[model samples]
Target: MHRRHAPPPKLHPHPSPLSSPATHPVPYLHRLLSAAAPAVSPGPRFAVEDYLVDTCGLTRAQALKASTKLSHLKSPTNPDAVLAFLAGLGLSSADVAALVARDPKFLCAGVERTLSPILAGLTGLGLSRSEIARVASLAPRSFRSRSVVSGLEYYLPLFSSSESLLRGLKKYKYFLSSDPERVVKPNIELLRECGLGTSDIAKLCLAVPWLLSAKPERVQVMLACVERLGVPRRSGMFRHALKAVESLSEEKLAAKVEYLRNTFRWSDAEVGIALRKAPLMLTKSNQTLQSKSEFLISEMGLEPAYLAHCPVMLCLSLEGRVKPRCYVIKFLKANGLLDRHWTYGTIVRVSEMVFVETFICPHKEAAPNLAEDYDAACRGEMPTNFRFTWTKNRL
Candidate 1:
């Protein structure tokens, strides 16, 4: 009792210069810093919904909907590990948010068994953390898959850079998820069998990466269809034809071919010629082809057969290059300056600099406003002189 009597005079903390010696005083500068700093506290006890909404950046409604799938998640331990790993990968908080929003189940993945291994394998493939982050953000489901490593292994060398691969992922969104052995590899081999070099296959990947990820059976059929379009496999246009036919089923391709035969007034042989010249025209919507046909055949006084032979003109912008140049020609004709014979190809096919130098610059003395009027026409406006009726010039 005597020893316990005086408990060391109930020692107190030294008073801070910034505050009174009451409760628990801290250092003067620390006290002032604390007083000035905004109060921060641990987040509200880790409800999955709360974490999804607050930490993962899902909206309240999205959190509510997505939380149901995560009902088995009792703690934030797994999600926390996943988030820490993603953060280490150089993904910004917003990128994590978007990736989670797109695939909430991504958080439930095993970090050691799935994510860490994927990171290590991709690192072995020489991809920097930023490139891996882009792939993860673009395809989270695939990012968690074991096959992703092999897919990137094959794709990185073919694509030559992570930038092109990311672009393909954005457009297809399923490249990494597709089975590398059964689907992607087989289809790529098929492309090789069809005589596509690494460069050609890489070019095809940029256009229709999904084609490589498609079933081998379907790819073979589509490749056959592309070959039948009369663009020889050796031609540079072969890859263009591959992209054109990749989206169309045999039925749709046939319908489009028949529609082309009817719209452009082409025979079977002419349809082949047009498709070979510009396979992209087959992918154009009916409305786009129809409008171009009407303009080239009716307004421009070109024959339908001529368009079949020069189908590249259909690929040109009717409003951008064709219409503006047509207006310039009409302006020259109205002023009687273009006395020489001129074809639409001569007027429309030259590069912009050449077109201006050849058509607009030469007539500077005749019409001072020709270049100015042409500039306005290129912007989709109709200058007054550009719209005037003029006698048609002989071709």
Candidate 2:
């Protein structure tokens, strides 16, 4: 009943119906969709999947996988620039494809920041455009890592020439990815400590770069193993021994040693003697050991002691060099075309030209089929009925 109740407490104007939550309630999911729509939607006329397949040479599946990493790309401007830069460097479409396939993120790399500097650095290193292209094609991953320039800088001087460098790069692409300070340099130092000079080390790196890339401790162990086999570090055979040991695993070495001992009934001393003479004997397969030993022992009546003394005879090709030459010698002796004084070791160690002339050319008149048979045996087409009379008197 108050006379003037402040004009009924004067309510503020009601919120407009347009702005009322009850009148136009936006669901939570709808609000989220509205907020995120801009980001998830594709740009007009720019489809990343399509761009990858059509321009980058990726298949639909590859593009789909690559698009996950490149979702931020709304247009082809950056990738197009990357492709253009690669193409301008003489990379064929196949080369570009290989690069993208190996590392799809390459497409997203900054040209000026990442790729251009690498290329410029390569060129500055005296790599011609063609050689650079070859490197890129052969090892695209070489450019994807940050260590390429450092790798090249460390390795370039080790090679005698740019041709050698190119050969090493092509042969072992892992050179670009290898850690010189951690892996290469330490291993090289270990090799030097083992009496390898700079030139010898360079030869090893060219022939077997993986050996230098091995763990330092492992390389040291291998060096020790080689030395334990009686190969003197100062001897020329030392390098060959190192190469053969580097190619073998511990299990393989064990297996080969066991095979030589058990299969040939060789004592440990004899095996050691053989291995010291020709370390490559340990690298031969078990089948090769059996076949060659059988031919030398049973067919030619060569004593195992002889092989232990001259183990390099095992390294000769049984089919190509040993068997064919042996057949020629046997044929010549049976027909009295060759002197019986020629030894098995002498025949095997001779040059191919000498063997052909001494065994094949001289006897072609008396035995017209001798040269033909020798050639046939070399090609692995020897007749099943082929036999040679073993001359007991010659031995």
Candidate 3:
């Protein structure tokens, strides 16, 4: 009696076209209804810090630190997918943990859109799954970018092999971020233009990857400095020379050049001759140059000009090859076992087996303890025969 209500509309066995599930998919219908429904308060906002610790395996400290980036993370849905994708890619728990700690925001990225495409492109480039995983773990910030695959493609050929590329990448943290076309490609092209072959470029890039990654203009200047050092582009040691000069400023390089000249008592022309022969001398430390000069010039009685003529001698080890072999040669000479004079360079550069065969084995009966004494001298010990050589020199 309070009010008359209209009768309820009769239900049809078949649903109306507007409400048909075929026309409006079930998921779409659910979404549409949700959109029309009045807003209800969402459950207590997702606990990002706790989720990071429990699900992502982050330490409380890591979670606390990483949570700041994911403060707006409302659910674990995207992170769950991302973690699953990483696992499928063969990333170990440590890899995932390290990656997340480095870039917590990476977890919130769309897996289907971002991660899958990046992985596919890298695979197409012939990188094994494991290598790709390591790449991601090594460069989290770069891995998040789509441009990383192209960067790797540019580097792979320059490195010549994946193993070599990986080794270089371990030292070069910016491999992924650097612009290959602008910075790296131009430097490599310049190297090629200077008569550096592919093999030579590969060796230099592995030795100092930043050479190519450095700003092209900066690299051109460095190349000019190298050219001024008197190392002809065709010299076998040109790459070695390049590595020596790239790290040093002009002032430091000048200091090194002066130190070498003064320490070796070289005339200006002689300095150029020595550097042209072994450009690696520019990188030798003051102590190294001093020690070698003292040994070759003072103890061995070799002329400064002789060493400058064969600067490769300075590249040999003082304690290992130079001193030990020189002592052996002297011991042989003092004992009258040698019939002919042996060049200092010949003794210093011979292989261990060759030295043992030509020097030790040939006179094993004459000097039974020669091999033993040589071994002792190599370990920086003073052998009796070595002492005898000194006595002979004094006499």
Candidate 4:
């Protein structure tokens, strides 16, 4: 029952594929794997081997991966052999270079599978490593400066639209349309009021196309034409049109007409014709006065004969002298009082005397605020039994 059992057969640990030394000729792999593998039991007999294995502590997994990748990188067909050989697993030579070059330690994954293709594309475009690095180092805004036009036309279009471009163009169209100078709104308005339509305005602009490029000025011109053409006054001649506006008169319409006639050297007949045509040229005052006078004499009991003499008599009272008496004539003419040929100093003096006696003689007052007898006032007396009659002569 106590029979001795044979010792269990000894089991040996199977060597890992990764345990084999790297045979790849890639110097980067040779250096990396040899340095990375753990030191053998007695430490390397050669100082070179001892230093590498002791200093770098690369794991077996790191060595095996580096060797396998370097095998492919060593091929002539590989575009980036040096870079690929340096890369372990997915890393490239460019990635190692960047990592070595950067003064500060960074946690970013070295350019591996994802970034390698981009570097490859850059290499295909004939971009040097330094140029790629420089571009990569630049911020987006700085990079755009390298190709502003291309950025706007092509790249920006990817983000914007033709309509957006048109809006920008419209905003700056003034600069395109005309000369920077020679643009003024009022001047344009002057031209437009002179009877220019939109087409005419456009033609004018075409004649001076550079004006369109002018800001406010070009816009002003177009607007002016629209305003002038759209209004009732056909002729865009604003100043002349304004002349017509200034011609409107309500106070002393006849006097204003005379003034205009004298100022413009127009004949009375012509002036009268114009006034008749545009009755608004007469002011409300003149209209009212005319209507009042017309109503007083024709509709009321006031006599036209007495009213006709009123203005001349008033002139006599105002003049304080019986003279060459042109003043009397002026007064009569102004008030529609004179005959067509009523002149001559003899007649004037006679009329003055009559006016002075009949109207200019002062009058008296009986009741307070009573209209007086023209003669009684001259005598400085108050008349009894005063009738409150109003007359131009008393005034």
Q: Per the 3 Å backbone cut-off, how many clashing residue pairs does candidate 4 have? A: 21
lDDT minimum window of 10 residues, candidate 3: 386-395
lDDT string for model 4 (1-395, tens) is 89999999886587443553554347656778989999778643323222212322333444343333333222223223323423422334444434323311111223443345555654554445654444333221222132322322331232143343333333332322222234434444555665656544543443343333345554444444333322233543332223233323334434655554543334555544433333333333444445434433443334433433332221232112322133333434554444366532233346435755432342322122222333343343423342334335422
Question: Following a full C-alpha superposition, what root-mean-square deviation does model 2 have from the true structure?
Answer: 5.2
- Per residue, candidate 2 scores C-alpha lDDT tens digits across 256-338 of 78899876768889988888778877778899999987888888888888888878789999988898888787777776777
Model 4 lDDT at residue 309: 30
TM-score of 2: 0.83
- Highest lDDT model number: 3
Distance from true location, Cα of 224 in model 2, Å: 1.5
Candidate 2: misplaced stretches above 4 Å?
1-21, 24-42, 64-69, 387-395
Which scores higher on lDDT, 3 or 4?
3
lDDT of 2 at 42: 46
Clashing pairs in 2: none
State each model's CA lDDT, in order.
Answer: 0.83, 0.79, 0.84, 0.37
lDDT of 2: 0.79
Task: Write model 3 residue lDDT over 246-361, tens digit each, in one string.
Answer: 88999998889899889999998888889888888887789999999998998889998989888988998888889888888877787787778898888887788998888877
- TM per candidate comes to 0.80, 0.83, 0.81, 0.15
Question: Which is the leading candidate under TM-score?
Answer: 2
Winner of 2 and 3 under lDDT:
3
